[model samples]
Structures are given as C-alpha cells and as structure tokens.
Target: MTFLTLLLQTPAAGGGFLQFLFPVAIGLVLYFFMIRPQQRKTAEAKSFRESLVKGTRVVTIGGLHGLLVEVGPETVLLEVERGQRLRFDRNAVARVAGNPAAEGATPTPNA
Candidate 1:
C-alpha cells in the first residue's frame, strides 16, 4: 500500500515526469520545424510537376538541363543536348530553368 502511494506521488529517477515529456516535446518541435515544412515542400513540388506543360525549359533532379518538348499524364520529353531527347517522369524535374517564351524580347541583332 505504501509503495503504491509513493509511486503515485513521485516519479521514478531520471527527471520523472519531465523525462517522459521531454521526448514528446522534442518530437513536436521537430515536426513543426522540420517534418511539416518538408511535407509542404513535397506537396508544392508535386503541384508544380502536375502543372508543367510542353515547351517549358526545366532542370532535372539529376542536374540534366533541357527544354520540355512534351508533357504526358505522368512523363515528359526533354530535349537536353540539342536534338537529343530524353524521357523522365514529371516529378523528376527539379525546377523550371527559365521561361523561354518570356525572353523573346531581344535588343536588336545589331546591338
């Protein structure tokens, strides 16, 4: 009876209640700062991959640079080495290299 009362009144050694709570607090902190942000970034990347279209210049996750020649439902055709085409999943594109359509404004060929 006395042991039960002591056990209820006091936590065991090694910081008792605080020890149990510490790991949980750390986990929550990691989730908020690390895990949650990573999940959000992954979702954003997925959305970006879904929204990609043909004729867009893009960089691959493997550092291959190319222009998006065709966009399929799940894959894409990339013109990497000037007339050399390669295929990859849409999600394999790390980022758009540059908007070629937006850079058509040239300051005269003479300049």
Candidate 2:
C-alpha cells in the first residue's frame, strides 16, 4: 500500500480497547485535577462554617466583612459597625480573617 493509503486505513485490532481506555483516562484526569480539588475545597469551607464561633472575624461571600457576634445553629449575627448587626445564614460566610488558605491561598502543611 502507498504511504498515504496506509496512513488513512483504520487499525484492524485493539481499536475498541484504545477508544475505551482514552475516555477512562480522561475521566481519571478530570476527577483527580478538577473534581477532587473542588470537593476538598467544599469540605474545608463546610468545616470552617461549622466551626464558627462568636468573636471570629469573617468575610461573607457577598464581600461583607464583620465580626461574628453570635453563631447560631442555622445562622450567624455579624456586627458590621458599632451597634449595627446583620443576621445571615451560616453558609454565607466565605472565609475567616487572617487565614490565607481559607481565602484561596495555596494551602500549606500547617494550614
């Protein structure tokens, strides 16, 4: 067969296995690189939310920064200004102040 004709011809064997393996490899790559890191971030955020306590300074997902005045089971009260408090759902908290890792910084071994 001419070089051009040989190049155009499909593989006669192992093509099906190669096709299956390609997609499986792609899935594993996506899971490890994308999905797994996202899951870890979500778990860390949830843990941070659950561990909140009064007197912790936090920033909300909406960019509102305040001191946590009260941490309730389903919500938290934030003191934005002197005598000015706002109540928000617990999930609204994005990260605690002074924690670079929680604010999307590269996580360290001690973080």
Q: Pick by TM-score: which candidate is best?
A: 2
All candidates: TM-score: 0.67, 0.72
Considering only N, C-alpha and C atoms within 3 Å, which residue pairs clash in candidate 1? none
lDDT for each candidate structure: 0.88, 0.89
Q: Show how many residue pairs clash in every candidate, following the order shown.
A: 0, 0
What CA RMSD would you report for each candidate?
7.2, 7.6
Question: What's the distance in Å from true for residue 79, model 1?
Answer: 1.8
Supply the TM-score for candidate 2. 0.72
Q: What is the lDDT of residue 83 in candidate 2?
A: 75
The total number of steric clashes, by the backbone 3 Å criterion, in model 2 comes to 0
Q: Please, what are the lDDT tens digits per residue for candidate 1 over residues 65-89?
A: 8988999998999997759999998
Q: Give the alpha carbon lDDT tens digit for every residue of 25-69 in model 2.
A: 999999999999999999998898899999998999999988899
What's the true lDDT of residue 62 in model 1? 97
Deviation from truth (RMSD, Å), model 1: 7.2
